[model samples]
Target: MNDRSNARKEQRKKRYQRQMARQQKGSKRYQRTRLNVARIQRYRANCIKNMAHQVSHHLVADSTTMVVALEDLSLKNMTASAKGTVDQPGKQVRQKAGLNRSILQSGWGQLRQYLLYKTFQRGKLLVFVPPHNTSQECSRCGTIDKASRRHQSGFACTACGFTDNADRNAARVIARHAAYGLIRNKQPGQELSTVTLRPIPY
Candidate 1:
């Protein structure tokens, strides 16, 4: 090999060797580095909260209804699935390398915090409900189906022929669940129906 290629290979060999050593030692330096790596996560989280606050605050202020509904994403399922990479060789390939890190970093949690505070400041009610079936359920007729999500960015109901944004559909379901709580202490437990909405009469 040429001198330059030989040097590059040596550097990579050293790096992989060090990484393996770190894995083996399992020492304080390793732990500290991991903690430092987590700082990226922390910063992204803060950004998400801030954006959620701004967006939710605007939505609540502009809307006629003061009730703000939020999806409970504490148990995340979908966003974690977004991982794909093209074929590349002889490089440190990070899964998050080419991702739109800034856009995703906007901080949904921070936005939610902003919404909660703003709603409280404005004397409005903010509510959260389970996030299941929100995207799959029809907003107009209260239909729920696994096949409703024809694609990632859209929702189309086969049973009732209702169509709308996925987030909006989820928001409507959250609102309905919130309203059910207001009328009675216990929220409705029955499933949503497309042809005949039972609990709140969609």
Candidate 2:
């Protein structure tokens, strides 16, 4: 969808520029081109929203799922632009901008919002555990090391020599954390205003 959107955006940009140069600012042709661009953007937004709804509904409605655990991610902070002020210009501005666009395009915030309300309405527990070291930690041996996930999709534990998909390992870790009641108390309607977790028995 992003690729298609970018292609369409480029094509529309050229046409819009040409129309503005030749036709008047408030001319019919210029207005028409602007409307077309807005329509395409709206369509993309609807598609992303629908996709998030479907995925969130599935997780909440699944009979086998009593608790759903996810990494506590701040989408806004994760996708912030790296363009600094003129006094101190930022580096990798182009790459950061591209990454920010991709993150926003993926609708992570929308998905989380859907999951939040749906899970609450369905009477299911939704927990967000700390996301740090989830991908690097080995699910089998509980070892934490950066080398465990050397590839994007692969994971291999250096301690136990266990191999699995990186995403799957992270999911397992999240589930285990939830099972152990390792989650911050931040959900709505909760009386506690502080972070709470079960103490691990040594």
RMSD of each: 12.4, 6.9
Residue-pair clashes per prediction, in order, are 12, 0
Residue 123, candidate 1: Cα error in Å is 1.4
Clashing residue pairs in candidate 2 (N, C-alpha, C atoms within 3 angstroms): none
Looking at model 2, report the run of 10 residues with the lowest lDDT sum.
193-202
| Candidate 2 residue-wise lDDT, 136-165, digit = tens | 988887899999989878999988999998
- Where model 2 places Cα greater than 4 Å from the true spot, the runs are 1-24, 81-96, 182-202
Error at 7, model 2, angstroms? 6.2
Query: What local distance difference test score does each model get?
Result: 0.58, 0.72
Assess candidate 1 and give its lDDT.
0.58
Q: For model 2, what is the C-alpha lDDT against the true structure? A: 0.72
Give candidate 1 misplaced runs (Cα > 4 Å). 1-50, 75-104, 186-202
Candidate 1: count the clashes. Answer: 12
